[model samples]
Target: MLKIKNLHASIDDNGVLKSILKGINLEIKAGEVHAIMGPNGSGKSTLASVVAGKEEFEVTKGTVLFNDEDIEDLAAEERAHKGIFLSFQYPVEIPGVSVTNFMKTAINETRKAKGLEEMPAKEMLKLIREKSELLEIDRKFLSRSLNEGFSGGEKKRNEIFQMAMLEPKLAILDETDSGLDIDALRIVANGVNKLKSKDNAVLVITHYQRLLEYIVPDFVHVLLDGRIVKSGGKELAHELEEKGYDWIKEEVNA
Candidate 1:
């Protein structure tokens, strides 16, 4: 459902370009989970941001096709409306905006784009309650400002809740396991597993194999120095976790 061909990207406006993605070619079909594992500064997060149409990075080459349409030029919100979702590594806290209000706006905007009416408040609340329970989030969180004063684990759970609410076609989770304890991790993984379907796909970007044990990916890709140097199955993650990324770096330089 997603195809990225010969992708390249850089940052900043002065054209002092440092390419982060070097000729990336990847295809994520529907009903699959793809795990991207890499060391720090390997461009994994950059790829996710680029696909979500984040404005900070400039795509110098390559095409990102979503469901057969080139979406490289689409704005972030436009891409989101097209069913692309990115769960950020660091979720921002918006003071004064209740979680319920924020979610309602996002849901309504997405529905409007699909030519559907806004979901009724009663239905929205019911869905929220169900999803929150599944994620083990307290109902009181719905009344608070998004991510405000929430613990690290609570923030991650909130991100998953938002994902459940949006129901995007493609979900890119950037470091979803960061700062999560074992209990929180299990809860988050269970929510993701429950949400997975034949029609939707997930791209999980992480550093450790611990998360993979909970959410097994169909494919695992190793990125080093801004490129994918190795691709394998679930065992690759185990290898990386055992041997660390230094060997991958050596292989890349060789």
Candidate 2:
């Protein structure tokens, strides 16, 4: 459902152009889960931001096609309206806005974009209940302001909850496992796994292979130096876990 061809992205640091993603080529089909693993500063997060149409990073070349439509020029909100959802590494805190209220506004805005009326109050409540249960979130927690003073685990789980409600066709989870303990990681991964379907895809960008144990990926890719240097099956993640990124760097240099 998502295709990127020869994509190159750069960012400006005080007027100095610094390249991050140098000629990336990837294709993700529906129902597939792809994991991107790499060392720090390998442009993993940059790729996610570029795909989400973040304006800070400029695409020097290439195209990103979602369902055969070029979305390189589309704004970030436009991309979200087009079924793209990005879960941030650090979820921001919104002091006074309850989770339920935030989600209602988001869903209605998306519906308005599609020329649909607001969802009926009863239906919206039903959806909130169902998705919260799916993510194992407590009803009381939904009313406690979005991400405000939430623990790391709660923030990550709340991200999954938001993803569940949005039902985006493509979900890009950028370091969702960051700062999460083993139990929290398992819960979040379970939610992601349960949410997976034949009509949607997931792109997980992580530094460690441990998260893969819970949410098994169909493909594992090694990204290095602003480009994807290798692509392999799930066992590739195991190899990286055992050998570290040095071997991948050596192989790329070879």
Per-residue lDDT tens digits for candidate 1, residues 76-184, read: 9999999999999999999999988999999998899889999999999899988889898888889999999988988898999999999999999999999999999
lDDT, each prediction: 0.93, 0.94
Best by lDDT: 2
Candidate 1 to native Cα RMSD, angstroms: 1.1
Count of clashes in candidate 1: 0
Q: Give per-candidate clash totals.
A: 0, 0
- Model 1, C-alpha of 37: deviation from truth (Å): 0.6
- Which pairs clash in the backbone of model 2? none
- The TM-score values for the models, in the order shown, are 0.97, 0.98
Error of 1 at 167 (Å): 0.7
